[model samples]
Structure formats: structure tokens, C-alpha cells
Target chain A: MAEIITVEHPEDPRLGDYTSLTDVELRRRREPAEGLFIAEGEKVVRRALAAGYRMRSMLLTPKWVEVMRDLIEAADAPVYQVDPALAEAVTGYHVHRGALASMQRKPLPDAAAVLAGAQRVAVMESVNDHTNIGAIFRSAAALGMDAVLLSPDCADPLYRRSVKVSMGAVFSVPYARLDPWPASLETLRQAGFQVLALTPSAQAEPIDRVAPHRMPRAALLLGAEGDGLSHRALAAADRLVRIPMAHDVDSLNVGAAAAVAFYAVAHGRPGE
Target chain B: MAEIITVEHPEDPRLGDYTSLTDVELRRRREPAEGLFIAEGEKVVRRALAAGYRMRSMLLTPKWVEVMRDLIEAADAPVYQVDPALAEAVTGYHVHRGALASMQRKPLPDAAAVLAGAQRVAVMESVNDHTNIGAIFRSAAALGMDAVLLSPDCADPLYRRSVKVSMGAVFSVPYARLDPWPASLETLRQAGFQVLALTPSAQAEPIDRVAPHRMPRAALLLGAEGDGLSHRALAAADRLVRIPMAHDVDSLNVGAAAAVAFYAVAHGRPGE
Candidate 1:
């Protein structure tokens, strides 16, 4: 069972991990360096714990303590019950969902390991938006895509906003950053995966026409919102695919596009 | 030619339509009541005008005056030139986007009218998040879905955040609020449409299994994120369709789900 402590002072040194929560750049640097990431609200906190992530500690308002009693009873970490005002003071935002947990982040799995037996995978390049990262993880997990491979510049999938937006699916969908980016894509190709770059270019074949599931394995590569796939990344892909657009609309946001592309790879051309 | 009028004060009554924009409830009531909606940033403002929405006025920082010279030369509306500080003071947030426009809201087209010649459409129920609304509109437009029909409870697609998020695709896609709830859904059926309710229920047919385009006309019905399709809406649907999620994932965010569903309806089961 966890040890419960009551904290009155907002300046408590033990609460350091939760401080400066809203400072994006600082937290981005400090969290990874400190080997910790935060999960906000009851849902995300519960999910992180359920995913086998070790809890460093938990901070909760009095009301949420009873709400998260099951987790409290099973956890080995210390629990600090603090005033809502103190939580706001420490996190620099209102703790409206009433609970936050700081969890020890696990080392990223080797990309080859995640790809070894995987049939469908998503590869993101320079998708730096945290929300897009979260949304894509959620779709990849739900659509039964086996795993995710990120370019070096993709945002952290375990970031607080990403965890909340993904409803913790980031934990279920295994992912690793591909270090050398375009060249590192060789990892998937060597694993018998057909790497397809998703683009809005007219010259690319429509995604449905590709029927990716017919291949022994497939990886769908996506890029940032405006610039799309880098020229080098596009050249690295085995084939270029597109979701046919209409009405002169520019393109779907990367998150939406990822969902559609994931679904196409998963089930659009069944009976392969 | 647009009249360029310099406004030195944030308190000027001429800026009424642009005030308290970050306040969701107030802007929700005010923008619609005044038969006006706001468009933020350069791309969205340009799309709004191209969609034939009359500009009541344009507010731009001095630097953007030359940037929007063509618009100024073409519009008869007044352009208020304000300092950066005054723009923030009036809108309650940073005006980093540098331009804002108040555009007249056209009367919503009748649901039957939008469905008359449409092959594919999206029906949203209680999807109150402006971001989801915007994302859905964007996907619907790009995926070649003809129009959108919203439950009266759904968020306004023309809301400033929605407009900006959709990249002004909301202006290109025709939409109308379906009054009288599920009863108004009858309007689609009466127009010879197959209404398919999208749910995450395991027993529901996989979305790809239902080739909507093979039908004479089709409407894909979606619900909000957490609590999806109400009992009554499900009962009203001609068929219940699902996306077949894996990994014990609860559900996809409604926005992502809508994109996949729209593509399934638009491009799935070709040559059927």
C-alpha cells in the first residue's frame, strides 16, 4: 500500500517535478532529463499505472483521493494530498480534473524489436505538434496498427498533453524514435516492410488503390502539416500514396490524415 | 475601396464584434445573435471572403495593411488599423495572427437542400467541441463528402476557432442544424438516404464492410467523444457501423473517427 502524506506548503521541495508544469520548453528538457513524465487527471493517471509504468509519486486533491482509492491501495509510491490552490500554484494551471501523477518513463524499445512481427506500422516525420502526436497514437492503437516509428524531430508522445489527448493509448501503442531519420528508415525496409509515403501530391496513386495489406508488411509515412514529407523522405519511400481530395480543399490536418491512412492500411482492402 | 480608419483605443465601440473572443460562452451567444462570425489569420480571412461571406470589417496591424492590399482594394468594408497592444487588449489574448475579420453569417441551408444532390454526407450529434467540429468539416471537404448536417446541440462550425482549425473549409462545405433532433433525421430518409450510425460496439458491422457509395445516397452519423450515439439516434439509424478498434482502446477521438468514416464512405468498396 502507498504512504499518504499531507502537504500544506506550495514551496515543498519534494514537489519539484510538478512545478513549472506549464513551461513547455523547460518541462520538455527537464522531464526527459529527470526520467519522469506527468499524467494529469484521473483517467490518464489510471491508464499510465495500468500500462505497467512505475509511479514515482502521486499528487491529488482531497476529493480525488477517495476517487482513486483502488490505485492508492495497489501503488507502492507515496501519495501527497494537497490543497487545490497549492496544486494550482505548483502546476501553474487549474487542476480541474483533480489528480496528477509523476511516473518514471521506460526506455524506448528498439525499433527493430517492435517491427519484427508487426504487420502494419505508422512512421511520422517532423510531426512536432504534441496534439497530433497524441491523436495519431490513439488512432494507431485503435485501428490495430502494430507499432509507431518516429523521426528524430517528432514530439514526445509521453508529454502531458499528448497523454491526455490520446486517453493514454500512447502507452498501448509501442513506439521508438528512428535516430538517423531517412537513412534509419532502412530498418523497416530490411524487415520486409513496404514503406509508403502519404502525400497530397496529384501524381501519387490514391491510397485505396495501393491495397497495402496485400503486402507482407506495410509502413505509412506521414509528415508535418504544411510542408508534408521531406524531399529526402519521399525519395526514401518505396511508393507515394495519397487520399484523393475534392473541392480544392488544401488538405486534412495531419492528425485526421493519420487516422484515415491508418484505417486504410488496417482494413480498407481486406481478403488480401 | 476599403476605408482605412486608424483606431487608437481598444475601447472603441466599433470593435464590439471582436471582444472577449476567448470566452467561449459569450462568443457563442454573441456571434450568432449578431448574425456575424469572426475569421482569424490570413488564410482563414481570405477563404471566408472567397466563400462569399460579406466582410463587415477587417482589423489589421499596420504591417498587415500592405500584406492585404488586394483585399483592401477589392472590399468596400472599413478596415480598422490598430496597434498590436490594442488588438490584444480588445481580444483578451495575443493577436499573433495579425489579422481578424467580422463576416456576415448566411442563413443555414435547409437539411434537405444540402442532401438533395449529395452522394455522401456527415451527421454530427452533440459534438460540442469546436476543434472536432472544425476537423470534421476539413475531412468532409477533402474526402469529397458533399455536405454536413449537425444536431442543434453541435458546436458552430463558423466559430472563430473552428474556422481557423478547418483552414476555412467550413466556408466551402455547406452545413445546416437539424432541428427537432432525431425527428429531423427523417428528412434524410425521406430524401432517399441510407443513414448509418457510427459506434464502437463490437457487434456493429465494420465500417469498411458497409460500402456507402454503392447506395443511392448515404449519411454517416457520428456522436461526441465520451458518450457516443444516444439510444434514440441509434434507433433512428438504418444500420449501425463500427471501426473495429483493437488493443482494448476505448474509442478514437470523434474528430479522427469522422475522418476515417468519411473516407470509408467516399472511397471504400470501389467498383461495387
Candidate 2:
């Protein structure tokens, strides 16, 4: 079902998708342009395939070949077997998980399409950290958030780090980019979703009291780690909601905050 | 009040406390044996001091010298100012945070001591990842969990990475190691606390339905990321509870689960 090619040279052009992966800036630009994302490790690579992503190719060490035998047998894409040393040289790090797959990224749906079938949503603004975005996606999917709408400046969810950190959750959660940001938020309101901005502002109502879970349709807006939602993003929301914090903590990290908020909004809902 | 020393040599004995920071195994063993922990970046350093940890010494780049002048003037500990390159040479990475402090570690309170005045508590078992422990501490502190009790195998909360990742919340929240672990958990039950084991098992009650927040005194037990609560640990708990996860996620990362659990246990409680 698949062709296994033995690759010895680090410079092989066929391995282009797997090169310089540790160079985040280079991969960040190259991935979206080339319409591919790399999924690392057996679990994530398998998940990517299960989610209907087309595999461009796979790079695996000898030991992993047998471990991933089923996937290799089912794949139509070429599998390259390489020595671990060469794999490390090409990727700029030790490929500890022993397997990597380059998956073709499908075009993201428009915001309207993503929101059409979803009742609970997470709206993120300028959440550019790859790890934070990945963690949020994992929580969003796990907590039953229906969809994710990202500001144009949000980091690529399919970035290698994001995908790995998310444990391939990026493949599971349907997400779309809101090109005009705060202005595009009006579209959520028109869809009968109440947009609540999540912030640490003292003046904001406590999220528990807002009882987002009671809302028939709710979208919670979140921002980046340190500098939270921009003025316009805050102004656009129907209400400002803050997670009640104690012990004088300035705020929870974005991932923890997103998880708590997602849980809060999804709590008390009937089982799906 | 503090002596200002300019250290030019990377091999200087005075900088021993800050050596080989990137080597996890080395630092993990050394920090605890030496009874000191490192606080990196200005905010964490200030928070550590504010929490009453005595500074053994401080490592600062030239720029940080001014920013930390008030601290330097108030401390009796020696402050070593080094150039960035030398700081990098000594610590095994770029000291991007520009400040590092080696603070004395106090003797941890016993489990019974930590449980004495606490109503909401987090008990972690074999959660050896420094980042996860730090994150859990941050969430615990922010969510108003009164104390943390750790299985003896859990990572040190005062390890440098834990301190940095916790944003010094580790210092704010008191924690103790339960020497005999699952057996020691009985002390919590003895203290009139309901010990709730957080698991993803289908048999476990959903955390929300359990209403941990309504419990007069509750202790949430968390395990490591992958192999959650050892069978023995789960068997010891008064009840088994789980976050109501959707989309067939295997589980939330330990940090997120801890945050959500902490919020649930502390929700609707009187403000501290």
C-alpha cells in the first residue's frame, strides 16, 4: 500500500518537508505557503490520518517502522526510512518520538460555516504563542466547545509545535480565521450568540455569575497570555466576564484560563 | 544593605548556585540538596522575596542592576553582576530574563500541618514534571486552593523551572510531601476532608454533579499526565470524580485538570 524508500543523505530534496523544523520562523512561513503541516510521534501522526488529513509523506526510523506498520500499510504516501542521526541533523533536534508525517492542510472554513453548527465557541485574539494555541485547542475540543474563531494574527494551529502540544487536537476542532477581528465579532451576535469577552479587569462581572452555561448560544472571547484583549476587542463584546481569581494572582496562564472558561461555559449543559 | 560584586570569571565559586541550569537532572538533585531554589526574572524574584524567602545571592545582567536597585539596597545577600555572555556561559543558556536569585528553601510543613487550616486542597501523586507542578501551583493559588499536598515522588515545587513557571506562586502557596503517599492520604480523611480522586474512568461521577464547591472541606487528588492515578491511589480515595470531557478526548493535561478541579472545589465559597 506504500513505498518504503531508504534515505541516507540529509540534503535529499525529497525530505524538504522535514528539514529545519526547529527553525520556527522558517517553518512558520513555509508550512502555510506549501499547504502542509508536520505531525510528530505515533499518536499524533495516526490522529492526523484518522481526521482525514492527506499524508504527503512520512519519515520514520527503523524501530518505528514496525510500530507504525498498520499506518504504513494503509498509506498511499511514500515512507522514508532514515537513521536517527540523519533525522536529527535534518530536523535540527532529536526526533524522540521516532516518527513524523507531513499532512496536507485543508483550507479552513469561513467563520460563518464554522459557527453554523456550533452552540459554544471560543474566540481568540492575537494568541500567537504556538504552545498556548495548541493547549487551548486541546481544551476547547475536550470541553465540547463547538468551534474556534481566530483573529488573523493568531498563530497557525497546524504549526508543528502547536499540533504536537495539542496532541493532534488541531485536527479535531473545526476553526476559522476572522480576517477583520473585532468587526467580524458582529457576525457572532447576528448568529444569535452572545459574545462575552474574558478579561482580568476588576470591573468585569465574575464569569460564574454570568452563567455562560445557561446561555443558549455563547461565544467567549480570549486574548494572549500577558497583554489580554485589545481595547476594541473588549468594546465589541456584549459583556465583560472575568474568572474570579484569589491570592492576588495577576491572572492564570492563557491555557489554564481557557480551560477553566471552557469548562464554565460547558458546565450544566445536557450531555451530547 | 547588600554587597555589589562584579564577577567576570565563569568558573567563579560564588556562581556555583547558578551553574548548569539547563541540565535538569543535575539541577533537580542539586537545588534540593543545597536547600535553595532559583527565582528567575524580576517579577518572580520580587515575589519570592515578598513571600519571605531569604535570598542567598542574586545574578543580574547590567541592565537588571538598575531595575532591581531597590531590592539590592534592601537585601543583605551578595549581588553578582555579570555580562550577558558570562551569564550565558555559567547557566548554559541565554539569561533572557536578565535576573536570577538563589533563595533559601524553608523546611516544608508536614502534610498534617498544611491540612490544619485548609478547606480546599490539591493532592498530587507522582506528578514529576516541573512545568506541570508549577502550573498546578499557579492555578491552585489563583483559584484559592488553600494548600497542596504531594506524594513523596512529586517534583520539588522550589526547583528553578517550577519557580519560574509558577510565576512564584509556588512561594505563595504552601505545600508538603506525604511521605507514605496513599497511606498518608488517610490523614486528610481524619481531618474531616473528603478525598476525591480525579480520574477519566467511565465509572467516575462527573465533577460538576459531585458539586465539590458545595462540600465543606474537599481535597482533590491529581496524578501525572499519562498514567493517571495509580490503581492503589484511586482505591484509597473516598470518592472518584472526573471532569466531564467531550469529543472523546483521552484527558486534559494535568495542569488544566487541576485548574478546573480547583475552580470547582472553590466555587461559590466565601471570599478568603
Candidate 3:
């Protein structure tokens, strides 16, 4: 069980992690080295607990402490009980969701380890938008994709906005970063996975026609919304598939397109 | 051809339709009883033009007007050219896109009208987030879903944020409101459509097993993120189907889920 502490001062030193969050540059500068990330609302806080993230502390109003008692008790951190107004003042926002948790960020698994036993996976390159990252995780989790592998340029999956947009699925879906770009893709191929690059190019095969049984393990590679996959990444793929789109439509948003592709590849697999 | 009009004053009465947009209440109040909606950025403006919405007027910076010569020449409304700084001052924010257009809103098409000749369609109920509404439109268009029909509570598909988020596909997709709640769903069945309600319930059939060819027309019924479809709407469908989700996952965001469902229903058919 976690210790319950009462805090009245808005400028308490313990609350520093939650302060000035709207200042993007300051938050980014402090976040990475500090190894801390914030999870807001009851759903995400519960997920943080379930994911085995080491909780540092929690801030909540008395009402939420009661409502979320099961979750607070499951945490190993101190739960700071504060007045709603004081909590709002400390956090620099209204804090209407009533509860928040701060946890130590976990290191991602190795890309090879993430693909070792996976049947279907999503590989992202240069997807910098946090909301898109979150939404893709939510889709990957809901559609039963085995794991998500990211290139170095991808946004932090644990970013506050990503966590909120993913509706807590970021905690459940396993993801890891792959360094050295297209060279690292060889790790997936070594594990007998077919890397299918998703593109809008006319020469690509339609996604549905690819037989499921031929490739027991598959990786669906996606890129950023506008520029799409880099030339190097496209060249490295085992095959390229296009989700046939209407004329004059540029492409689907990266995240939404990922969901469609994930479903097409992951669907109908046994045990799902 | 659009007549060019020079506007020097930020508070000019002619700019009333484009002013106070950041104020939600004021903007809502100014909305035409049937047709007042805003479209932002050059691409969405072009889509709006292609969709045949009667443009009330356009506000553009000199740089944008020069760049969009072809689009401006195709417009039927007056083009008001202003300096970038003045345009920002009038709109209450930095107008980075350098262009905006106001259009008279159109009446929600009758559900029957939108469903006519449609093989695959999405029916939304209480999916009120504007960005989600826009994303669904983008997915529906890209995946070849023919139309989107909204329940009365759904957000305005033509809202500026929706237009921008949908990548302007909201302007192209046909949509109408279904009043009288679940009762309106009967209209779809009468049109030789089998209404498939998307739910996460364990008892529902897996989406992949759904026979697409048996029904010449199908409507996918989706709901908001949290509450999902109301009990009444769920009860109205011909059959319930679920996307096979992984362990401990609750659901995808309604918009993302809509994309997967749309792709499955549209692409699952025997022939393209």
C-alpha cells in the first residue's frame, strides 16, 4: 500500500514534476533525463499501475482518492491529497479529471526481442506526431497486433498527449525503437518476418490479395503522413502494399491508415 | 471569376462572418440556420469549391491570392485580400495557412438520399468530437466507403476543424442526420441494406466472418468513444459484429475504430 500525504502549498518541492507543463520546451528538456512521465485521469493511472511502471507519486483530490481507492492502493508511491483548487494551482490547470500519477519511464525492449515471437507487428518510421503515435497504439492493441516497432525519429509514446490520446493502450502495447534505420530491419527478416512497406505508389500490390499463411510472421511498415517512408526504408522492404484509395485523395492520415492496414494484416489470424 | 476586393480595416463590417471565430459561442450563434460553416487552409478551400458549396466570401493574404490564382479564378464569391498581419488580427490568432473561406451550410441530406446507390456506408450516433468526425470522413473516403450518415447529436462534419482534420474529405462525403433515434435505422433496412452494428461485446460475430456479398448494401453503425452505441441503436441492427481485440483492451477511439470497420466492410467483398 502507498503512503497518503496531505499537501496544501502550491509551490511544494515535491510537486515540481507536475509544474509548468504547458511550457513545451522546458517540459521536453527536463522530461528525458529525469526519466519521468506523467499519466493523467483514472483510466491511465490504472494502466500505469498495471504496466509495472515504478510510480513516484500521485496527486488527487479527496473525492477521487475515494473513487479510485483500489487504484491508489495498488500503487507503491505516496498519494498526495490536495484541495481541488490547490491541486489546480500546483498543476497549472483545472485538474478536472481528479487524479494523476507520475511514474519512472521504462526503457524500451530491443527491436529483435519485440519481434521474436510476434506474428503481426507494426513498424513506424519518422512518425513525429504524438497523437498519431497514440492512436496507432490504440489501434494496434484493439486489433490484436503483436507489437509496435518505431524508428528513432518517432515521438515518445509515453508523452502526456500520446498517453491521453491512446486511452491508456500505450501501457499495454509493447513498442521499441530501432536505431540505424533500414539496416535494423534485417533483424525482423532474420526472424523470418516479411516486411511489407505501406505506400500509395501505383506499383504496389493491394493489401487484401496477400495470402495470410504464406508469411507466418509479418511486419507492416508505415511512415509519416506527408513525406511517407524514406527512400531507404522503401528499398529495404520485402514487398510493398497499397490500400487502394479514391482518385484525388492524397492518403489517409498515418494513424488511421495504420489501423486499416493493421486490421487487414492481423484479421482472421487464428487465436485472435 | 471572383471579384477582388481590398480590405484595410480589421473591424470592417464585411468581415463579420469571419470574426470572433475563436469564441465558440459567438461562432455558433453566427452559424447560418442551415448553411454557415468555415473552411480553412488552401486544400480544404479547394475541396469546398469542388463540392459546390456556395462560397459567401474568401479572406486571403496577398501571398496566398497570388499563389492560388487557379482556385481564385474558379470561385464564385468575392475575394477579400488582406495583409497577413491584419488577417491574423481579424481571426484572433496567427493565420499560418494564409487562407480561409466561409460557405453557406447545406441541409443534412435525407438518409435515403445519401444511402442511394451506396454499397457500403457508415452510420454514426453521438460521435460528437469534431476531429473524430473529420477523421471518419477521411477514412470513409480513402477506403471507398460511399457515404456517412450522422445521428442528430454528431458534430457538424463541415465544422472548420473537421474539414482540416479530414483533409477536406468531409466536403466530398455525403452525410445526413437521422432523427427519431433508432427508429430511423429502419429506413436503411427498407433500402435493401443490412445494418451491421459494431460493438466490442463477446457475443458478437467476428468482423472477418461477415459475408459481404450476401448483402448488396451495408451500413456500419458506430458510436462515441466511451458510451458506444445507445441500447436502442444496438437493438436496431440486423446483426452485431466486433473487431477481434487483444487481451485487456477495451476499445479503439471511435474514429479509429470506424476506419478499421469501414475497411473491413468495404474491402471484404468478393470482388473490388
Ranking by lDDT: 2, 1, 3
Tens-digit per-residue lDDT, B80-199, candidate 2: 999999999999999999999999989888988888989999999999999999999999989999999999999988888888889888988888988796998999999999999999
**lDDT by residue (tens digit), candidate 3, B182-240:** 89999899888899999998888888777553458989999898899889999999999
Clash count list over all predictions: 0, 0, 3
Tens-digit lDDT string for candidate 2 (A156-260):
999988998898889898999997878999889989999999999999999888888989999999999999999999999999999999947858999999999
Say which docking band candidate 1 falls in.
medium
True contacts kept of each: 0.75, 0.64, 0.64
Worst 10 residues of 3 chain A by lDDT: A263-272
What DockQ does model 3 achieve?
A: 0.59
Error of 3 at A231 (Å): 0.8
DockQ, structure candidate 2: 0.58
DockQ of each: 0.69, 0.58, 0.59
lDDT agreement of model 2 with the native:
0.92
TM-score for all predictions? 0.97, 0.96, 0.93
DockQ leader: 1
Q: Per-residue lDDT for A1-272 in model 3, tens only?
A: 88889998989998888887666667766877799999999889878878888889988999998988886677677889999998878777888898888889988789888887789989999998888898899888988888999999888888888999888888888889889887999999998999999999999988877744246898999999899999999999999998878787758888878888888887663323
Better of 2 and 3 by DockQ: 3
TM-score of 2: 0.96
